[model samples]
Target: MPRIKSPALLVAESGADREGHGLRRSMGLFQLICFGVGAIVGTGIFVGLSDSVAQAGPAVVVSFVLAAITCVFTAFAFAELGGAIPVSGSSYSFAYAGLGETTAFLVGWCLLLEYGVSVSAVAVGWSQYVNELLDSLLGVQLPAALSASPGDGGAVNLPAVLVIAMAAALLVRGVRESARATAAMAVLKLAILVAFCAIGLSAFRDGNLMPFAPAGIAGIGAGTTAAFFSYIGFDAITTAGEEARNPRRDIPVAILVCIGVVTVLYCAVALAAIGAIGGDAVGGQPAALSYVVDEVTGSGVGGGIVAFGAVVAIASVVLAVMYGQSRILMSMSRDGLIPGVFEKVSPRTATPVAGTLIIAVVFAVPAAFSSLDAVVNLCTIGTLAVMAAVNVAVIALRRREPELPRTFRVPLYPVLPLLGVGCCLYLMYETGWTTWLQFAAFLAAGLLVYLGYGRRRSRLARVTPDADATDAVPQPV
Candidate 1:
């Protein structure tokens, strides 16, 4: 039989290994919630509203609801597993404890696309908001050649590269500092968004909401696919299992709270955007909310405020998600499935300094030159697949380790997890076929890496090629 990490071992290794390196346990419930909000509520609400609106019209609000529903199911599963098997690596760790090495590797692969590629895409969108803010407040804008990526008809997205660099520097300083930065920015962005919603709803026109769901069921499905991207960061809360002060309780509570908070905010913003300007006006825009604010107030000042908020919001995502990605790599490296440099925590910073810098440089190239659309779909697809694996891990663990202690359990046992899997698959199908092809390519690449390098180097591989729960390469707790 293939090796599967026991839940007991997963818990036992929650502190530092004999080597004296481990993630600092500094995050409280508030910081965990801040990380969740910071990871989410960024590029999606600030920039993606236009694409979703074009697909579902005023029904984009419905799209947000449906997407949130799907996330709720998966979030339940994540809360259950995170509490029971609290560890870094989130879904990848869950899979290792429940499904075995190959599955865990694949989940980690999906996460690479989810976090790594996503940072690049979000950074690209951040450049657009930067240009918007400059034009509104400074009466000057970077030439497209500097602000836009080569794939977007420019030489390089310099702003995107700049944001990634800033985030990388902050992350290398320490997770505590990262969480503080995320929390402060999260508060600012939330307040700005709330203010925008109030201002927009005040001028709401009943006629703008007419002809909702103009594209019907198909449109809603497509729109839901895009809206799911907004919810991507909530799972990142689970990735903080090792660093969180009380992972058993805080992880589940933070997961649920984060999802609820984000859902309400998304629905409010979607409604506000649709009501303030008709779907036609909101569709195909770069910075929809800021544009609406500028239009409603009849001045650039209102837009400038919203744009400034967006600049902060998008920067928070880069910081938080980049943190999540580094932790994921650190966990993988601890398993001997990747290079050891990732797992090497800097004693001064207690962070993955070397790995974070490498990750930044690798993905920064995409942010600097690739098209935003090119990365977005691949990221969404990867996220859906990783989420589905998490749902499966929940079921697998329940059956494999019936005695495992759980601080929280999914409300309906296997039913909700099953639904979570279904929702993830349905959303994947709703996306364009090109995304499927890209995801397939990524999966193939991961398989090659695992078979060629990870399979031979894994600690489990050397432990007689069978179950070695007590002595396999344990993750960085």
Candidate 2:
């Protein structure tokens, strides 16, 4: 049996051993902020907005607010934990420090769903925009047989597969290069969104906001469950802790800044779209934002512009989310909870080449055949569970290790963590029983992996009684 890893040992492994593994600290605050924005602003804003509106009517704005509030609480918790631990595993690392290896493995398992499934979901959404862009610009469209996901009326989505492969190629180059690419794409996406809001606002009709809470507070709760997915990737900032130029100082700032910037952008875009064309026009549409642009501009030009932006946005998201996933696998491998191959960082590129390729294949195969809705639901449910664990981890750490050095601490302590936990559970309840069944099945598979492999191979089990291994490693503070 393996002994549980202590918090101090976790911190040591994150800083020194992580460097020994070849991860370069090349990302700065700006790059990290870009990563978060790239991940958080993609498919949810461009494609899922329609579903959100259909669920909550005009009051979807309040839903966005509620979701933002929920994320803000968790973001603070992530900032504190990431600063203290400064590890690549995000909430998974935090759980190991505050809870134990068993809990950490479970959180890591959930995050596998959050980041991996999210990459696939965004890829599927990207396929829709690519097909739409072709139809708008060249008056040509891929045949339905080739463009749609299986059982969604098509054989396979080639575009989705291509995009995932492309993102994986870029990631293999190096973290710095990937960060620069993500930053550029994020800026382009933000510019397109701002343009849409500016032009669409001119068509605003106050009447569109009437009966805002059409379905009442219950609708707001449902809307929040969906909108919460929009804020999913802000925590990706914390995953870059080991890669950040100044992990303790920069990671916290980047997390909070990313959430603040994206929250404002989401609310503004939602308001502009609904106020201009009304909720009914946007609901259940595949290209809701582009549709609003076309409606307001009275031509396909605006739609074409939005379609191009959506391509950039969705690809950026896949890049950021995939980057985080590979790093998490790397961390888990370092703990001996998975095969060490995932922990292998290339000497020249300093990136996890083997892990990135593996993730790309996994993401592309399912993305080519499954409907986006099922994977998106899995991402949402998995994320809420991971976040709720993180919130509890923060409280547990505070009580268990008050003397530990922390660069950022959650304000109001127990209050915020409690609220975050409550909010996360409430949203999980709102996601419907079908999603719960899917998440349970997913967790069962993770348990099999843990029981079959992780439990026996964990590094803690290899240490002898007379020799203390971690004593040789310098502690990070």
Candidate 3:
């Protein structure tokens, strides 16, 4: 049987002086905000907007609002837990402290699917835009054999492989240096979006929005499900707890602020896209924003600019997601749930070199040869389940350990968390039965790993002299 680890140990693992084994606390509030923004504004918006518009017509605006509301509730739960735990595992660490080791490992496993597949999906999107940008500017494009996935008529996606490798190399350098690169990319993408919105708003025609909500309330729900992916990356902020200068205060601030910024930006861009080209065209075009710019201006220059921005946006998202995955693995390794090598930190860079390399390779292959839709479906299913569990963990901790100091607290008590769980479950249901079956298969595999290996190796199973009484629950181990 697996045992539960105390919240104290989780917090200490992050902040304790490890004689050069700990991650560097170098990120400030600004870098953290940039990191969250970099993660949040990605292919989900650049490529997903058209899908949402197709589902809800011009009513995609309502879908964005509904999705943001759900995320806000979930974000509140994350903020409270992050402030209290201040650990790198994000939801998994919180689950370990409040639930048990079995549950924590499951969350970690789901997160692996979420982050890994998200990186792959973004990489594929990046390749498409890079091809578009090159064709627009130089009258040249990579051969289909090198630019597309196996099923998409190409043997390998060279651009996708190249971008993932670049992100991996940058992460190996150091967290601060990586953060600077992400922040710069974040600023560039934001500026491009602003320029898009300005040009698009000028072409707004009220007639385009006439058939809003064309598919009825059902369409609205479908649209919400589509737009929700844009909000998925905000949780990556909490995974940087060990690297934050003031994790308790900074993580919560960055999460909420980034969500707010991205929500407004998403709506602005969505509105512009619909207004400039109407719902029919947006629904059909994969590169909706670029197409809108070209249509409204009657010149490919505007489309070229949006294509460049898409490249920057997707690259930054891949960087942030990869960073988050490594940290989560390192946290699990520290608890003895996985191989100890993942927990190894580089003395010079204060980063997990081995874990980063493993994640890069795992995602790079899929990005090069797999279908983007399959990756997106897997990412969505895993992310929804983990987020729902996090909401439950927040409520459990509040009831079980009210004395724990929380720099940030979720307002409205149990209401927000309960609502968050419901929204997450609804989204999961909307993902269809096939996805649920896939998720079940993934969870079953995770349970096998936990029972066969994680249960026996968990550090919390042994009651050391320094271990807390609460952590020493006697079990079959």
Residue-wise C-alpha lDDT for candidate 3, range 257-284, written one tens digit per residue: 9989999999999888888778998996
Best by TM-score: 1
Q: What do the candidate models score in CA lDDT, each in turn?
A: 0.87, 0.87, 0.87
Worst 10 residues of 3 by lDDT: 468-477
Model 1 Cα shift for residue 159 (angstroms): 0.8
Which ranges of candidate 1 are over 4 A from the true structure? 14-21, 468-477
Candidate 1, residue 82: CA error in Å?
1.1
lDDT string, candidate 2, 94-164, tens digits: 88767777788989999988988888888989999998899889999999788788778999988899999
How well is each residue in 1-477 modelled by candidate 1, as lDDT tens digits?
A: 777877666556545222343678899999998889999989999999899999999999899999999999999999998888777778888888878989899999999888988898899989999999999978999999998876678998999999999999999999999999999999999999999999899879989998999999999999999888888888888888888888889999988998898889988888888899889999998899988987888888989999999999999999989888888888888888998999898989989899999999988998998876766888898899988988998888888777677889999888899999999999998877988998899999999999999988887666557664734444333
Question: What would you estimate as the lDDT of candidate 1?
Answer: 0.87
Look at candidate 3 and tell me the lDDT of residue 151: 95
Error of 2 at 152 (Å): 1.8
- Per-candidate TM-scores read 0.96, 0.96, 0.96
Which ten residues in a row are the worst by lDDT in model 2?
464-473
